[model samples]
Target chain A: MKILVCVKRVPDPETVIKLTPEGASIVTDNVKWVINPFDEIAIEEALRIKEKAAGTEVVLLSIGQKTAQEQLRTGLAMGADRAILVLTDQVVEPLAVARVIEKLVGTEKPELILMGKQAIDDDSNCAGQMVAELLGWPQATFASKVVLGGDQKGAQVTREVDGGLETLAIPLPAVVTADLRLNEPRYASLPGIMKARKKELKEIPLAELGVDVAPRTRIVKLETPPKRTGGRKVGSVQELVQVLHDEAKVI
Target chain B: MIEWSEQHELIRQTFRRFVEAEIKPNLRELEHGDTPPYAILRKLMATFGIDQVARARFERQIAREKEGEAGPGERAAGPEAADSAAMQLIPVIELCRYCPGMVTALGVSVGLTAAAIMSRGTLRQKERWALPLLTLETIGAWAITEPGSGSDAFGGMKSTARRDGDGGYVLNGSKTFITNGPYADTIVFICKLDEGNEPRERKVLTFVLDKDLPGLTRSRPMLKMGLHSSPTGELFLEDVRVGRERLLGETEDVPARAGAKQTFSQERAGVPAMALGIVSQCLELSVDYARTRVQFGRPIGEFQLIQLKLARMEVARMNLQNLIFRQIEMAGAGKRMTLAEASAAKLYAAQTAMDVALEAVQLFGGNGYMAEFQVEQLCRDAKVLQIYAGTDEIQVSQIARSLLRG
Candidate 1:
């Protein structure tokens, strides 16, 4: 079985985030890049699947600027066998990335594609589902448990929903998006890191993948949510209940 | 106190996982039952490379030269350069001191097993036998002890080796309480060369015997009180005829007088590092347990009693760690100690390990005495520290004797 896991490169979680002067993007002048925390869980899942079920290969797929190559290398160091860097200097939106990955999946013909539900940096939880739609494949989003189906062409995915947890038996050629509760990602050892430098990394440009860089949503401004002010307190429970019912109107 | 560089941190994490998965869980059953953790211990042999010592030695040599402490462009270690050997032994000592069983298994499996081939075997012998010992393909036993040969390991050795027809040697020996002897594929059997001569000077001969060789017999595992995971057993080398290729150090009559001098010097160097490792292990066990275990109102770690124990453990640990390193450096730099100095470090560190481990158990109280607790295992394991690699009494004797000679 061939599995393609889409990974993202994001600023290290240790680095505090701050907005730029225009407030449209982040101020990432000098911050360490790491595989997104959620993506790490996705990578671990792919590796575990390949380990438990024999004759499987995990190919890391990442889309961003050139630094995405470094992120892909990080995945390779953590035991991914192969990597594909989808190149684009343009601010590639989630739908565009999803389309690109879908195109790559069509070329590779992987049995399953796994990715994080969303990148922590952008908080755009749309790529995995969009790719599933583009390829007309079943998607298991926010997946915490994945058991291979008896038929080999399907899987039972357990994930969270609005009110409670749910399970979905999705057929093969499926896309899986991970949540935080999957598995802890292992750090790459020195030997693994050294070997990663010699791994098979194939870089396919955005134009080569034949997906156009198109943004469906444009943010004119980015601002913090307004803060709530202090509320007045009443002397007793009865008085507080009356105030809540009357002035506060929260009863 | 244990700080990992960014590069080593990854390896540390891997090793930590390895310990959790392989060592920590089974440490209880293995220690109590005296069942040697042969499989996992052997598996961990892959992690530490054989030439790590040589590499460390090389790095230390270069560092010292660059600092201009030694003469210009001098590659050879001189009398003034005894510090490098000890420095080279630092990592090994630190690693083993954390876990004595780990080092003992490694030493016997690799260090002792390679003894015969390294000391006297021919080029053919070394190339073939040495490789297996180095990679842990065959565990090796350095057979030196007899029922009565505790302190006088060589002086009282009862095992005998007689040269048989044409190029074969027949060795008859019963080596007791041999480390790795129960499981060793190769045995470096130390025997009496001539029964009539003075026992101390001309009687000893070290021979390498293969376990598969005929007439060789071994007892089942001996129940040990501590360091229980280290395989110990009685070995009966009953007229075992090993080929000429198996003999170590010197082929012709062993030249016992010369080899004894060299072996004692090497043993002196080796024992100190082993002692350092023991103390280091004790310190780690104490500190880690203190931090996690709670007492009245707060972590016992916050209490002055626990703090004092930890502080003393650290002091002992750091002192021995450096002392051993200096000894190694001294050996590497070609300034072998006058016997007394070597025994002093070993004596101090070994006693320190016993003391520290005892205090660690005290800190753990009732939990420390339990078989399940790590501190109890360590406490049991610490007993051997006082006994082996030269007993404390033997060390005191050697040092005092050496002082008299001075």
Candidate 2:
């Protein structure tokens, strides 16, 4: 099976990125770069399918700047065969990224495309569905567990919804997005890392892909969420009942 | 340059798979049987080359980042003496996350293998010993705890080492709960020397006693409640003799060369750290089960009471991790923590682990007590962290003494 596992680079969530005192862009002084947390599960699930299904070829694809290549390489180290760097220095809108990936969907002609449900930074859970729409392909979003088709035609995707789970079986040449319920990402070993560097990395430019990479919406301002305020304490059950009945105007 | 570059996560993954395949399936047999997965551990070492992983992370990574070139990704490591120890801790944490016994065996071996090279071994000794240590060809054990002096290892011990008529020292003593006692190829044992200093201050009597040494014998394994995969046993040295060269460091300057004499309570927090990791793992397992396991046609995790337990487990584990990780960094810096700090961390972490493990079992309901599920095993595993490394009461005593003195 030919597979393309889409990846992204994001700061480790545990990392402390200080904002300027005025609260503009983040303070980059001590921030450490890491693979997008959700994307790790994406890569892991792709690798899992590949391991189970024989004659599997996994191509890691990431649409971002050069730093994104590091995350792609990380996927490569975790057993992805090759990588494609959709190299762009600036932040592209989710739709543009989906379009760029859609462009490759024709040339690569992979049977399946695996990607994270959303980037933790933007938290925009749209790109996978948009890409699926662009390609006129079925999408199995928020997939926690996936089983490749026995006849090599499609896969059964188990996704976690708000209330419960939703299962779907899409035809071959489909897109799947991973949630945290998927497997944990494996670390790269010394030998695996060495081998990963040797894997073929085909860099695709935006102009060559015939796609517009500008964002439709601008991030007017970035700021931290306000701290939660302390709650008022009620003295007794009588006081609480009184407040609920009259002071709070609940009754 | 020391480059601690190894795929720690990969190793962790491999071990999890290994546990699922070899251990999880046979946990029942392992619990009932006498063998403690020594063979399996050797196989893991062979396949994973754990020593290489250790060498890469502990010895090389810190060395490289400390003295060699490092880009933005790598932070500057601390001084040479402590960096490796700190870096060395990652494997221990990862390994113990699944099973603590086999890793404990691996840990004791590391302490034994490195002591000679770090403290006193010649260039040739390093060349000869490094390969086996890396390959796990020969097992290693540290024999510091005598019958009398476990916590107060250097305080006062009756095990005496008298110089022979010709040369070497005749070692006469006993070491209990020595990890890898039955199969260790090399041993780092301490003995008391009849000396001129005060009786309370006999100083350190350290030696690198090879396993083949005559008069050395091993007793039966000490059966434990948990850590079923690690073989812990007693060691007997009835007039065991060693050559002058085998005595670790310059024999004449042995008093000052003692690692124990170097504010040991602070530097050696491996036992406590191991305890912390086990506790954290227990919390993780419990919280996971509580969330997934269901009751009343709903996920039990949805209930507020269960949510509180899960939240507390998270907070407790995080607090323990932060505390232990801080001390690990402190020890890595070769800084000495007061006895109270060490005792407090150990005491709190161990008890926290036991409490968490029990909560995990409670959260699991009937299955928590079953051997089939890991929660009960976690409960069994949690008890040793309190008793063996340093008893709960002993830690309390240590803390009280330090507090009283201050």
Candidate 3:
């Protein structure tokens, strides 16, 4: 079985982002980049599948610039068979990314496609579903648990719902979007990191894939959230109740 | 300009994540409670395939030794060797950032004890003892420091191995400040060879000892000023009998003096990593504390004195990191530091770490003095760097002696 996982490079969630002078985007200089948390879960699930089935090849695919090679190498280090980088510096929208992935799917012909439900940077949970729609394959999004059937003919995916889980059995050649509880990712060992450099990482431009790589949406303005102000203390319970009822008006 | 390659950076990140997940939660237990660090260290080795790597390296080393192409003290001649060494040291530095004691405990077992056997022991001895220590399957202790001996380890040494009748030896000694001494399954016991020689001129003979040997007594862990996570204890060998097989190299001709000195140098070289960890952590904590901690209606970081402390810490960290980088480069080039150079590095690193840790504590002010703050633990741990391996005074002497000779 061959499993292809699509990962993305984003600024670490822990980084204190700063806006550019023009307020268009974040200041990228000196910002540390890491694999999207959800994507890491996707990669972990792929690795788990590979572990269960012998000779199961796990390939990682990413769509970004040359620096994205770092995240690709990280995937390889986590025991991916190889990597494919859909090289582009342009900011591709969800639909364009899905199209690029569709092209790769045609060429690679993987039995399964796994990716994060959403990238943390944009929180756009559309790529996996859109790609599955484009390929006309079944998809299980928000997957917390994925169990392959006894005969390896299908998978039972448990999706994390509002207050419970929703399980669905998806046939082969399916796309699964990993949710937060999918699985905990394993660390890349020192030896694995060193050996990752020797693994195959093939890069191809978006043009070569023959996909319409145009953004369908434009980001109008980027701004940080309003600064949080310190709370004030009330003298007594009566005063606190009065303040809550009048000023806050919640009570 | 010590820059980590992408690979090295990735490895550091991996280790940092592992430490946070595996080691951080148990910080209190490991530091204050009776939790031994071996199990966690073993898990780390297994997680990173360190045991497999060590096994492969050992097999190759043994093969080279058999061919007589690589003898004891002979380093593998290559850049890869240095790169591999640097890779191995990365974890040490990372671990030290939070728990320096764990690194101390691990280094003693794998770095010092296993190395002692592999460098001087026969093939049978290596297979019997060194392999297990290297894999961390069985804890090992390199017992050299005695109650009577510290700086003058060989000269002031009172421990001795006497030539008993019928070719066996009777070992009698007491070793203090021995890392993993209490729980060591295997021990490399260094003592004077009683060949009826002058007290000051006895030959240093090293013997391989196992726990539960007749008349062997291992003490409980002693109270220490720092490095609480690493158990330090005492060992007493009262007329312990051992056959010729237990003797390192199976002969007295291979002087233990040279080998012990080499071990000291190796220990000295490793201090930079430990020191780097301590300094890096201290600086990080102090900076964060300065930014958030409010005093006089503003962040303490705005104060010039606190900024100066943080700045000096950064300087120390950079210097220590550069020292490690230089060591790595030389290691990659198949070169080892001279004893004098190792001493110089250790002295500077140890002093810098101690100073930085104290400054961090000062920056934290009263909170730093309290054990609740992590900086307090760091301060305690950093002081040991200057005391162990070789004390600051001893290092100064070693450096000065070399210069005088030159």
Give per-residue CA lDDT, model 3, range B1-406, as digits (tens).
2687888888888899899889999999999847999899999999988898899888988898889876666776676776798788899999999999999999999999999999889999999999999999999999999998988888889899999987889999899999999999999999998888897888889999999899999999999888899999999989999999999999988868999998999999999999999999998888889999998999999999888998888988889989988988888777889999999999999999889999888888899998878888988999998899999999999999999998
Give the fraction of reference interface contacts each candidate recovers: 0.07, 0.00, 0.70
TM-score of each: 0.61, 0.60, 0.92
Q: What is the DockQ of candidate 1?
A: 0.08
Q: Which candidate, 1 or 3, would have the higher lDDT against the true structure?
A: 3
TM-score for chain B considered on its own, for each of the candidates: 0.80, 0.78, 0.98
Poorest 10 consecutive residues by lDDT, candidate 1 chain B? B1-10
* Candidate 3 docking class: medium
- The candidates, ranked best first by lDDT, are 3, 1, 2
lDDT of each: 0.71, 0.71, 0.91
Cα lDDT tens digits, model 1, A53-74, are 8888999998878877777877
Where in model 3 is the C-alpha error above 4 Å? A16-30, A149-153, A162-166, A218-251
| Candidate 2 lDDT tens digits, B1-406 | 2232333333444455555555556666555546665676666654444556656544563454346555112434474434344445655665566566766677666554554444444334444553466456778777767777776766756666787867788888889888788778777777777665665666566777777789999876777788776777888989887787777663646553346433234333565556556666767777667667878988888988888778878887677767755754665565656667777877887787788778878888888788766777767776777776567788799889988887
Residue B203, model 1: lDDT of 57
TM-score of chain A of each: 0.89, 0.90, 0.93
Comparing 1 and 2 on DockQ, the stronger one: 1
